[model samples]
Target: MPHGKPGQAGSFTLGPASGDVNTAYRYRLTSGSFDSGWSAYKPGATATIAPVPPTSGTMVLFAEAKDNYAAGAANSVEFVVKEGDGPVARWNFAETSGAALDTSTTDQSLRDNAALAGGAVRTDRGRRGEVTVTRATETTPAVKSTDSGLKLNGTTDYAVTSGPVIDTRASYTVAAWVRMDVPTRNATVFGQKGVNRSPFYLGYEHTSKKWSFREVNTDAAVGTPFSYQRVESKRPAVPMVWTHLAGVFDAVNNTISLYVNGELQGTTPFTTAWAATGPLQIGRVHWSSVYSDYFPGVIDEAAVWQEALTDTQVAEESELIDAHAVPSVELVTAWTPAGAQGTTLRDTVSGYGSDLALSSGASLADDELVLNGTTGAGTTAGPVVDDSGSFTVTTQAVVDAAKILSKPDGYKAQILGQRTATGSSWSLWFEKTGTRQEPELDENGDRIVDENGNPRTTPVPVGRWHFGRLTADGTGASVESMEEALMDTETRLTGVYNARHRTIQLYLTSDQQASDGIAYTAQVGTGELAVGKGYLGSWANFLPGRLSDIRLWAGALSDSKQVSDVVGT
Candidate 1:
């Protein structure tokens, strides 16, 4: 840091003190409040950071030199500076209800700028979407800290500013963290709504199968046909995954460009430009004078700059937001056979000592947990579920249905469960319900009648596995499978609870579609989560079987197509 005099040029030059040919450097500017995050590491030449306005008039510069093997400690210096420009408009979407409060100082009256509509709402359940290469630790690239953002249902949900927020015809930039749920055609994430067509649309484009930042090259004229050209990202759009998108229009450069996760994608040379003087719309598109292509996901940390953002600044912005990505869906715990040891079933996902103790003479058969009907295999280690939120559980088990207690309908058993003493939260059950009585079938598929040639109305076991949910208020329901396994023929079961939709669904390997389930609307009950047993007042409803490879997730799996990949439908 040169510590240049006040009013001097604000650009700071960063140079490596010592380095090899492969050495690279990354730098950032911060004051105590606002930070410029970090820029992309560049090799060889020096890196320059122009004035990134801080809330205060001071800025702190930090630089780090790194090679393939090692990284140097960050060296920083402080500087007092003059004024600089900030975002023209910014929304954190931190509000739980009401409009998005514009935090930018563009104008004090524009504070309550964007209004929520069509059931669009704010949620603390925000940050990045659920997609990670593996279980993340503190040092991984995946974000650990959580953030808040806006949630939108695909049908009719959006947010619109009272007026236009940017100049479309001039050099400008827009950026946001988008988590798309559905790959709807031409779904718009953010743009300025125009009378004939939007000036810019940042969203997932179904035709190209990519996250795109598109700018309409022309607008519809009176009585003339409406036509326009645009630009889009090259990276494929990943549904239910969080990624940053930045659309840049450089009038001086005569081009429009887009960035995905801070990496610059392809650019398009453009000359035609128009001003669409309409309110800024989030999660929707207005094309051909029609309002549709509504976004089907979440948008957070949305912002717009009056000038085109440099590649370094865009990278910094992506890094800044990525650090706070919330992983809503994760494997909270996995109790596998490999983790079996003396007196315990270790959580394979975490580590040793974090295990479910084997008690009441519970034994292991080839590393699989073997428990008797009355002897439960419970855990005090993890209540793997957030009883009130979404969850998915899977287990490979061989059950002896003959050991299960009988009911008037038939035999019933609780395979896996987690609940409080007052009520049940969720459970996987094997139930035999009353099905219609029909004549017995012969080996040739013909009805086998008894005496007098009359068809006999014999009963059949309608036994099936199910996923059920019980609220603390005593309201509950289950989704039963269509498969029959009443005679010790069960091998595996999968259960899912989607808190957002308030449904408990079950899936079987033979089924091609997810089963329709009853509404599970209620608050989460308090208690420890366990395997191979259900709990009410005491340790009862124990499952007698070989249980292993138990996996648990904090969030529910998606539809049949997405979940089939996991549950192996």
Candidate 2:
């Protein structure tokens, strides 16, 4: 009878035309009774099949005989709405072409029959055509031993599984967050091929605690290493502290950049062109089976991109990382109140203005100010200002007071002196300043004089109005100076100070022509000096201008550099 019946009741099969069989046929859904007449099957045919709504339990399909049109031919298919209907399709990696490596085992396998009917395929896992790469996790190398609480042995090398291969000829950026149990040995974190078999790499070394970026030029008969720059952390990397690191190569600009904790720390130029072949590896050197310089730490959130990140993006990322790593702390500067003894105001500059008022019971003579758990004291004699207007005289005493007052145990002071036309050349002294005399003086007044009896007057030049900072640590101090004019000559002296009471007297001799004769000049002001006393002084005509910022510390500042920072010449 040469008769034909539907393959499956609901399934329809279209016949190809005698000559043109490649044309596609379209299908659409139609509204009709389940028992409607069968549609013709032909080339370029279009058919409409209505779907059974969920409310309907199931849909049955039957086929009518064709070719001679025989009736009552039993060809029917049934589909039921049951809990389990085997997956529509499964994927097999072995059957898939271009799969470099596939790791699927057990009855549910990537090679034999792995379900793909539900989700998209992972491209990196050699399953891209089906789905986009959504998420991935890279684990740190296993640890071998512990050195100073840091893992000592672990592989850092890795191979790109699948995705866009790194093109050295193109620009790219790489970033990662690392928490080393121990410092990394000089080793490669990441790198790829460049011109003449040269490779660009970002790495760190435990010995120096420095991170470096370099390019290897194998073009030389002997391989040549071209280092851009190495950045050493100002402070040593603490154990287990996660540090964020990043590197970027701009092929267009011929520049390479590096960032730490989102902060761009170093950059270099790449005059030579980059090659296009080598595989991307992390933690270990490329193509090396032995893992010697492996990173021994935890790494999270590593990323690579084809474009350089903007400075704003980098800063934002750095801030985000900092927030996650160290959070912020509230910083407050205040002063102790007068009459209340130890009571201190939350805001010293706010309540007392420029004058840090101490309680009457507080001893200004002690050269110290105790406020909010911080203690600061004066180092020299000039720091002392009595009820009487005159200041005691002594170069050593004045410098000492400046030092101690600059970084008081709990407070800091700013220099308010201006450049006087007097021929007396005084150098600004701080830790870094090359001035001869130490700003701090010992109990013996002889400290300022060298064996030669010279005044040790390499005047730390203070050309313009500026403030010097003195940071105190226990009995030591560090000094830093800042001024508006670059021509300002200032020396920094950082050293220890003794916060004892001593009167500062400014001497005016006719020949010296030093003193401007005002009984109470605007230049002098008073506040905390030593722990027990506060100072009050009137400049008179000696130097005109209101005393600006006066502060005292509870502890001694002994660092010579710190002292120089407190008062610049």
Name the candidate that leads on lDDT.
Answer: 1
- Residues 224-268, model 1: lDDT tens digits: 664444666553565554567888887877788888766677788
Cα-based lDDT at residue 421, candidate 1:
60
Query: lDDT tens string, model 2, 285-335?
Result: 442223345555533334555555544344333332211232111111123
Badly placed stretches (over 4 Å) of model 2 are 1-164, 193-198, 218-239, 287-292, 321-470, 473-569
Among the numbered candidates, top TM-score falls to 1
TM-score between model 1 and native: 0.45
Prediction 2 TM-score vs. true:
0.31
The clash number for model 2 is: 103
True-structure lDDT of candidate 2: 0.33
Q: Report, for every candidate in turn, its global Cα lDDT versus the true structure.
A: 0.66, 0.33
* Each candidate structure's count of clashing pairs: 0, 103
> Which whole-number lDDT from 0 to 100 does residue 439 have in model 2?
50
